[model samples]
Target: MKRTRRRKFPPCGRVGKWASKHSRSGKHMKTKTGKKYWLFHALSILLILMLVALMCLNRGNPDFQNYSNFYWDKDDFLKRQHEMGFFWLTRLGRLLNLTYEQFYTAITGLGLFSLIAWFYRYSKYPALALAFYMVFPFLLDIVQLRNFLVMGIALWAFSLLMEAKEEPTYRYLSLSLLLLAGTIHNTAFIYIPFWLVLQWPSIWVILSSGLAFTVSLLIPRFLTEASLAQSSSHVLQRYAYLFRGQVSLPGRIFFISLSLALCLAVYFIQYSLDQDRLLEAGVKPKAFQSLSQLAKKLSYLSFGLMPLFFQSVDFFRIFRNFLPLYWLLFSIYFLVPLKAQHKRLEKLVLSLFLLGILCVTCYVLLIFSNTDNVIRTVFKENILLRLIELRGQ
Candidate 1:
């Protein structure tokens, strides 16, 4: 009877073995994941093509303008433009006797390849991320902006820095990359605070101060005098208009209140998180608690909101540039407590969030499209005409 006995395998084990064998045979079918991967890639390619077409069709158009020419147009940008390290690159490339086509090809090729590499390395949905990058206004117009290549480098450096905390080598690489980026264009300076936030808090103030000092010294030399003259005039007028701008009393109050509430919420959340960490670490929580308390007190700073006289206010402009506020808002949404703990409820919440993001993105594209069209019309009607008029004058 024992010799005649046959061993039976469990159904689950049989399926597991079968599936494993099937996978090894290269006919492994993950219907869901495969479909998603293909779809993501297709969408990415489509988006990139659409963006390229859009840029190409409008390249000569005035709305898009010729921002790339800023570096080469000596009379227009002059000494001021040199402060941007890009001018140095352009000069070096020229000095090397490289043809214009050769230099351009090299820069654009590197920028694009780097971006593709970034997506491949970092994105869970690489295809979707690539699609986002293609259509983003910053990227779409980047090739036309001489500094955009450098900006891309800077952004990539920042992205690397985001993940480089544990790896000291990468941190140094990021610093070097950022320094190069700053040389190419100083806009990387805007992100220094965020970078500092990811670093040791003890050194944050000193590092920031040093960065500021470095920029103050290096930026002035390459300052595009031409652009600066224009930027200053525009900035000043914009400020004046913002501050003096007429706003409905209700609208003004609503936005100001909203801004204040948002800032306070962010400060409190951050403070709470810090306090929680300190408590968990079994450190003397009193000092940490006191600091958190101060942050909460300072959260009341929002109450000092002055009227947006005409919208040109420097304070308002500065406030408008505070992109970190959105990060806080996004964090709050994720932190929302759900009454129901059902799997279905969790799925529903995730789906709704994704849908909302899609809707918002569509709306933004529609707005940008409208603006692009308007810019095209204005450029067609008067860009050359304006130039002629200026010459006549």
Candidate 2:
């Protein structure tokens, strides 16, 4: 093979040289990106652990129902499994089962890990993302809500979906997981539509949302009948405390106006910002940034609307139902491009965020103190329920 010894390859002399150069450049880029991602993940995990720890420490004893009382629910579900129960436990237990004492510990550890994973997978600044998620008002208010377990599960599933490379298989799996999670709690239903919008935007989402709206319009009737049926037999006097709260229209109008104003302001500001940075960020800011920004601002402003919503409508009793939407929408801003024209503006924004956090902490403490009970209520009487008038009359 050396007989003709093609002239010794020289730099820039052959196509091979160009290919080699390109490969090296690509590898370098990959390495740099990988380093940044790992650093972000580590910081996210550290921040998440710290925040979770703070949440645990400051979890005040509020007068509310607790999840510990659900032993009967779990036991009943197990009993109904019959012959399938032991086999399911042996097999499924290997996957999800820990002893009773290990239950909460497992949930906490798994949740913390899932949270860290989600930050890394979702946000470029993972640490900041986790901090924001932790500080979210709804999350702060519903620390003891067992229904949120579904959300935790869905979050983990979403993380996996984000990382998955395949198309149809992963998308289907994610949907199935989302639906199963939704079944765990009515609030989980929000995730389903959101997932559809993110995944199958072509057909499924619009149809599903429209169908869902129609179905939602019918649910009250069905639920009312179910409540009446159960009232005769249930010792807790089913729906005994229904329709107990009211809010004035003037208050609703005020909140809606405030939310709309905030939305308009953010949209206008974001629309006037630089297009280059926005485009480079993989976000179509030049085209849809204004609308997205408005939606985000409105979502945050919607938190303030919950108090108003509860005051206005007796049927929309679960304000927490909208919370995930609030958090999810607000998180979109982190992906948007911001000029931060001056250090002062940046500092002002940072200060405002910090002030918001401080206010939330104080509010948490005030709510806890205002509660007329000793032990931390895990369920029916927790901050979220009372805030939504879901408490017994």
Cα deviation of 219 in candidate 2 (Å)? 5.7
Q: Report residue 87 deviation for candidate 2 (angstroms).
A: 15
Clashes of each: 21, 7
Question: How much is the lDDT of residue 36 in candidate 2?
Answer: 59
* Model 1 C-alpha lDDT versus the unseen true structure: 0.45
Q: What is the TM-score of each candidate against the true structure?
A: 0.51, 0.51
By summed lDDT, the worst window of 10 consecutive residues in model 2 runs over 63-72
Give the Cα error of residue 333 in candidate 2, in Å.
Answer: 5.8
Candidate 2 on 52-124: residue-level lDDT in tens?
5443323233411233323223334432232232233334434565442244444545555654554444335
- lDDT, candidate 1, 1-393, per-residue tens: 467768886799888998899886654445654665577668767755554333332324332334335434533564335345777767776788765445654565566666556544433334444443343333324333444455456545655554564566767777787677666645445445544544444344445445544553454344434545556454332223232334556546644554455445445444334334332222234433333332232223223323321222233322222222233233223323333456446546553653354344334433444456543443334334556668999
Give the per-residue Cα lDDT of candidate 1 at 244: 32
Would you list the C-alpha lDDT of every candidate in the order shown?
0.45, 0.45
TM-score of 2: 0.51
